[model samples]
Target: MSDQLDIDYTRRNKKPRSLGDSERAKLEEFIEAIHYSARYSDNDFEYRHVQLPKQMLKVIPKEYFDGARGTLKLLWEEEWRALGITQSLGWEHYEVHEPEPHILLFKRPINYQPPTH
Candidate 1:
């Protein structure tokens, strides 16, 4: 879908808005894209890493990306947890002298699973 979410980032009272139908569908589409890439790997021993650029990052609600740490996790934890995926923002170097650019890392089978303790 090529629709933009009508999110008001400058609101008061700090009320959180659930993603619109199109937005949620887009999120699931992105997940499916990542899932398909990880589909053939061994579930127990292998993980897939998908690097998304700023363009693709638009799929996510801006609040999550712009908020404090743990905010993003809190927003999408359910879906991501079910898919064994975890995300973080980091830099990637593309050239010897070029400045590194911020990127999102989506990794499968999260590095550390839930601790039984």
Candidate 2:
């Protein structure tokens, strides 16, 4: 169950950088499809195959998908779940925000240090 094959997505400033136009588009499409499926379908736990393209994967870093060992099927499932929760709620007037432009950005806490001479 090692996620040793996943990628890193963090930057030095501890902020996730914005995903490029193409990657963002693909990710949004992927998330939207899955979210809608989970929200509208009777089978919420159905297994689905969402293929993220190589170009989109290349823009993202290496750490985001490399953690958490468990029942999740894909490296990005956790993220998809987080984003799709609202859809599952069945809110009548709710406005589901599009996935963030930087969906692949990773934020890991780190101690800040100043350079010394």
Candidate 3:
């Protein structure tokens, strides 16, 4: 598949900017959910829908629906690497029994390694 990362995230020498508070909160929630799936499942991959809290939901409101929000936050490969994720796949790639039609299925082997900073 073609790389979907923004050109900005593609710059190796560029100093990645910090995510805003709201975005950070969302990512943290996502991290928890993703980690749960990864640790519990025996499969080589795991997936989770972004379930922002009601309070945080108000902040992002109509910007995105469930898994779509997760996809946006994880669109960049750099972000993927930071999360110890090997391959990230979306609805366009495959479907699962998720509540939302959209879902993010990620591939990380049982003996996976994260990228060194």
Candidate 4:
């Protein structure tokens, strides 16, 4: 029989699919998208890289074209700091841009900074 989500077998890991509980208690945040933009207007904007987990690179789909992009995931501060990626901006919230795909961007939360241990 299907689960509450329906047409499913067993749920792997956990529920909600946002951020799991143990992952939450351990303080982890991740976001993934095929496209992104900061605003509704303007043709384009600039962004700096906030690299994702190393495992993410493993699933890159085969390129059909020279510039074919793979998955773009946002690995927030807590997620990558222990792995020694210090440049994380720890951003959140994403919105799709029209006539665009294969990009990711976000609004840097006010005074956003990872906690120092």
TM-score of each prediction: 0.33, 0.26, 0.31, 0.27
**Decoy 4 TM-score against native:** 0.27
RMSD of each: 12.8, 15.1, 8.7, 13.0
- For model 3 the TM-score comes to 0.31
CA displacement after TM-score superposition, residue 58 of candidate 2 (Å): 0.2
Q: How much is the lDDT of residue 11 in candidate 3?
A: 23
Candidates 1 and 4 compared: the better one by lDDT is: 1
Of the pair 2 and 4, which is ahead by TM-score? 4
Residues 63-88, candidate 2, lDDT per residue (tens digit)?
43323321111223334333332322
Residue 40, model 2: lDDT of: 26
lDDT of 1 by residue, 10-70 (tens): 3211444456667776665455444222422344223333343334456666664434332
Preferred candidate (TM-score higher): 3 or 4: 3
Clashing pairs in 4: none
- Candidates in order have lDDT scores of 0.35, 0.29, 0.35, 0.32
Q: In candidate 3, what residue range of length 10 has the lowest lDDT sum?
A: 4-13
| Residue 21 CA displacement from its true place in model 3, Å | 5.5
Q: Model 4: residues >4 Å from true position, as ranges? A: 1-87
